[model samples]
Target: MQLKIVLAVLGIVGGSAIALAQTMQSNHGDGMDHVTHGQDKPADAFGLTEPGQGAFAALSEVVRFLEADPETAWSRVDLTGLRAHLVDMDRLITDTVVSETELPDGISALATGDIETRATLRRMVPAHAAQLMRDGRWAVEVSVLENGMELRVTSDDPAVVARIKGLGFFGLMASQDHHRKHHLMMARGNDVHAH
Candidate 1:
């Protein structure tokens, strides 16, 4: 029984990874496919919420600068450094897999596998995304319950949830959500609930 359980977990994880890779490959060359959604449109104003320093703060600042003055942002911001930050984000996304023991007390112990950080991010974006962009310390916790994988965004900031509902889901947040979700969901599919 133990062996069977382990095998099943491996299968699900493996399948999710394969699916994610295929999805990314399909969307890679299509440039305009991203724009039709209008998610990348520039914001004319900056956020009023007080932000603390971290990845989120940096991202929010850069986004404000970009939207307020795209010409200057294009000229002043370090595009290469931004790309490196994204690469770091990629690593953070994949590494966020949770373990079975981390589940709550009542959840059935039978189901076991990653919650796939990228997957949940697609269906429902983290409200504290700006903070996440600034610091990878925060994570979306996924618990392997018997019924399904429970997904929740866990952040140190108490204001994250409320702030997410506001008008700040801009460029950094958009790119992180789309790209990360594309990778996580395509691979995981609805793998979270499978027995």
Candidate 2:
């Protein structure tokens, strides 16, 4: 519909805005590097290096096991990695807040002109989400307890999710296809941006 197009355009423009701010940082993973951390955000967890490398690395084995056993995919995966993987993203999003009183400890320089903290993050969301999409790994958490593994697509931060979804890369993984190791599962949102 027209609405989708308008949002898409706005998302593109928002990305441009970040570029204009010159605050967009690049830290792409070469797909081959399984255990490395982004220079932007260093490894604060186990010696795992990359935030969720262990979880993503486990996907191939999980898929192979699933292919071998028709019904054991959910049971065979080392659920710890996937759960821990999503948790890392959750922590990152939670730590990202747009507050007038508090600028994120190390990101103030990324601010555009004289904008306030919230406005700066709002302007930066599109670019940040895109960057996160490129580097942040996601998965469909499946298990034997019920029938599937589900994450609350919508994060606690609506604004951040909206920006991510607006980028069209949202919902990158809302399916059961385990063939590909990385699922670009998106953060859900009620997008309200207009072109």
Candidate 3:
């Protein structure tokens, strides 16, 4: 009788442990670890997505270039280059229009800077075809052809968000100057762009 009771207790404990392990594994999504899950996949992933590879790639390249040499990046923006980039972005955004909820206070701060800086941002953010301003830190809704891409930028100050929204890659470069250190750029897929 004593032996049977000990075996039963051991069996129950082992079964509980296995069940807990399975639950944890499922939560992690096959051990891949999902950072976010949304309704619509990102535009870049969508096949018919208009903001095709060229548009996104150009933006990425511009961002990288600016990040590498922020001081002189603006100087490189000529009328022709700007127009070409804008055209590509326009193509992408026409289909991927994203709506934003509320603009964050920090993003509003960009308006406080000098006339030139403020003016630059005003012209640039819209020119880059950003759809709307949202409540998250460094947050903005971007439209593409097939779907929209929600870009969430997190930073402590409005200056940083303004710089990035206005300058794109160059703004990210400027962020390095700030005291709050982490610079995270997240591009989500699915309904992640919606809300």
The lDDT leader among the candidates is 1
> What are the RMSDs of all candidates, in order?
22.1, 24.7, 18.9
lDDT of 3 by residue, 56-92 (tens): 5545544554566646435444334433434533433
lDDT, each prediction? 0.42, 0.35, 0.40
Using lDDT as the yardstick, the better of models 2 and 3 is 3
Report the lDDT of model 3 for residue 10. Answer: 100
Task: List, residue by residue over 133-172, the lDDT tens digit for candidate 2.
Answer: 3433321111111211112222334554453344322223
Question: TM-scores for all candidates?
Answer: 0.21, 0.20, 0.22
Candidate 1 regions exceeding 4 Å error are 1-75, 95-97, 100-195
**74-125, model 1: which lDDT tens digit per residue?**
4434534443444445433444443222222111112222445444343333
Model 1 residue 137 CA deviation in Å: 18
